[model samples]
Target: EDALYQKLYASLKNRELATKDRTERNSMFARRYPSHAQEESKKQHDHFSLKAAQSDASVEASRLRRQQHFTELASIMKSSNESRINSASERARHHFATVQGEREGKWSNTRQRFDEIRSREQEQRDQIAEMRIIHSNELSFRGTKNSGSISPTSTLRAQTPGSISYFSNNDDETAKTGAVADRLISRILKAANSGKHRRPSEVGSVFESSNCVSSLNTSPSREKPREIDDNATDKTQI
Candidate 1:
């Protein structure tokens, strides 16, 4: 009976020791596996978040660079347009000034030419008036020399040397009749040379009434004919 009691006590003590060892092993496993899994999961989530942030930053920087380039190009175009407009305005102003100066110069020249023409016309009018006055003075100076002042009868008697004493004894009547006969002779000679015809009585009336020889000498005779002398017969005889 003492041996049986000793074996039963030993079995109970072994059972208690085995239960304690099992509880300690389950505690160690829970601490090792669950904490390692939680750390790995946290590391993966942090890496994914860093990559997403880098992509967002790159997209924003590219968009800002494009906006700056467009603004600079627009500013350059505006400056070029302003410069062209200013150059065009300057050219237009210069052209207008040149045209105005030319017009003024032309008007001045025309006015000067008109003044010269008027001066020349006044000088011509003065010259014509001076010529007319000189001609009138010359005509007034020569009016008295052309009128007949000597007596025709005395002039004819003085011109004839010996023919008056043979005509009549009264010298005044002989001078007057000689003057009439001289005038009639001159007129008859002039009419014959000029191809004009006159009556015999018209030529004979200027001579003295008793001078039949003088009347017959002054009048052209109708009964007797004149003979033409031939120069060819006289030259042959010479």
Candidate 2:
């Protein structure tokens, strides 16, 4: 409060001093000049005052124009900055969309390839299963055939007990024939169970069996007549 009062007093004191100086100068000029001359000087002062007022108006106009120009420049700079920001944002958005599209396309292609591979794998599994089933069925069929062939021979032997009389006189020939039949049956069973082609030895064995059968059919049997003892019969009568 005191400083404000001091500043006010200083401004009033400056104003009073300026007024006194103006009054003294005016009084001195009044004393030096006649009435008409004073009137002429007042006219000149008015004219100079008018000229100074005009100059002040021109300076104010120039300052206003400079301020208006600065305001326009600021507005233009702000608009340019906004436009640049908008363009950059648009470009970023477009780039993001493009990258996403490429990623999605890659993912779709990978999924398609995966599906194809899975389908092929499933097909392969089905084929392998089918082949296994076929192999099992073939093995079972071969086993059934072997059993049927062996069953007939066994049934025949069981049904014809009296047929042994044909070879009763030749025990060795009967034994040889039985052993050959057993060997041939065993070899056939082995070939069937193995599920493979027959070897050369097995084929030769088949020919051997055929030859034995042929020889047996063509050869004649040797038989001896029985002799009676008369002394033993006569002792039994006595």
Query: For every model in order, what is the number of clashing pairs?
Result: 0, 0
Off by over 4 Å in 2: 1-26, 32-52, 128-238
lDDT digits (tens) for residues 1-238 of candidate 2? 9999999999999999999998888788778876966897899999999999999999999999999999999999999999999999999999999999999999999999999999977766665555455444433322111111111111111113112111222335444444544455455445544544568787666747655445344223422312213332211000
> 1-238, model 1: which lDDT tens digit per residue?
7888888888887788777787676566657777865676577788877778877887888888888888888888888888988888888888899998999899999989998888866665554454344334423332222222222211122113213211222344444444544454455445545544557676455344435345323233333222212321211000
Number of the top TM-score candidate: 2
RMSD of each: 30.9, 19.5
List per-prediction Cα lDDT, in the order shown.
Answer: 0.51, 0.56
Query: By summed lDDT, which 10 consecutive residues of candidate 2 come out lowest?
Result: 146-155
